[model samples]
Target: MNTIVQASPVTEKSRQLVTVATPENAQYLTFLLGGEMFAVGILHVKEIIEFGNLTEIPMMPAFIRGVINLRGAVVPVIDLAARFAGEPSQPGKRTCIVIVEVQDGDLSHDVGIMVDAVSEVLEIPANEIEPPPSFGARIRADFIQGMGKVAGRFVILLNIHRVLSVDEIATLAGVATPGEGVAHRSGS
Candidate 1:
């Protein structure tokens, strides 16, 4: 399957600076993955779609469940569970895909992330957000953006950009397309 991302024009709405939205009023789209609460900044979110049949491609990474033709664009669907853990995500009644926009240089691409279910959008205050724990996280430390405290509970704020990095994933997946210039780490 061709996974090259085509660039689209940036919109005026997206031109608003992220700094304009402080944590005090920042919104997050919370979702469940492996029964754990996780969130992504709403600004990075494009939309959420119902779970649908996907076209599977052979020899791809396990985390890469398949691709879905979103409109006319071929968007790759990622199994979030498989990416973080080592197993594929099981489809549940509330299963769905969250379309997230990831930046590649000056261009943007929309990628689908499979999740157990979407909870709600919440406003997490600055005081309630804390730095990632030094350890004890199920996922890699770099994946976490922060720990948001809500209703006396902690929600994992994901660094979506890092998680959905096309070039990084493509390089690490051993399918780096020429001219993408996705640098691979030495001696993993």
Candidate 2:
């Protein structure tokens, strides 16, 4: 006698994928300033360009180097060293401009920070960063985002927004607008 065996049908159910919050991992573009290493979050950085001619505006703050024409858009360049209250950095062969976007309210401006040299981009785990110290920092405490520990070295991560506060700079410099058609050039 032959027996027929029946097999059960297999059913597939749709599964929904869910995402969970994870630790933040940030990347920074490192650069040298005054023989020390500094960094800024890569997201804020637009591009790195060769140091070029800048149209100097008169009566501007000492840290405000000048403005450069970037693809027809004027970009103000800041002397990072000078901004830190140190002597201005003399441009060298490796000198380059790091373009960063700073936002104010609903408007964003492209500002260039002059660095002695551009270093490598590093991926630093968020946990490895330490909060900015309350005192003894060469630059203002607000200017530092955190101190990133990298290979036993501390990299000063700059809070670009604080360092390049558009409103504050304009008010302090008494300039109309940085990178805005070279305003305030009459009173040198």
| Candidate 2 Cα errors over 4 Å, as ranges | 1-23, 177-188
lDDT of 2: 0.81
Off by over 4 Å in 1: 1-23, 177-188
TM per prediction? 0.82, 0.82
Q: Residues 1-188, candidate 1, lDDT per residue (tens digit)?
A: 44343333454433332323464689888999999999999888877777876888666779998888776788889999999997998898899888888888888888999999988878888888999987999998889999999998999999998888887778656666436564454443
Which residue pairs does candidate 2 place in steric collision?
Answer: none
CA RMSD (A), model 2: 17.9
| Candidate 1, run of 10 with poorest lDDT | 11-20
Name the top lDDT candidate.
1
* lDDT of the candidates, in the order given: 0.82, 0.81
Which lDDT tens digits does candidate 2 get at residues 49-94?
A: 7786777876777899988877767788999999997678899999
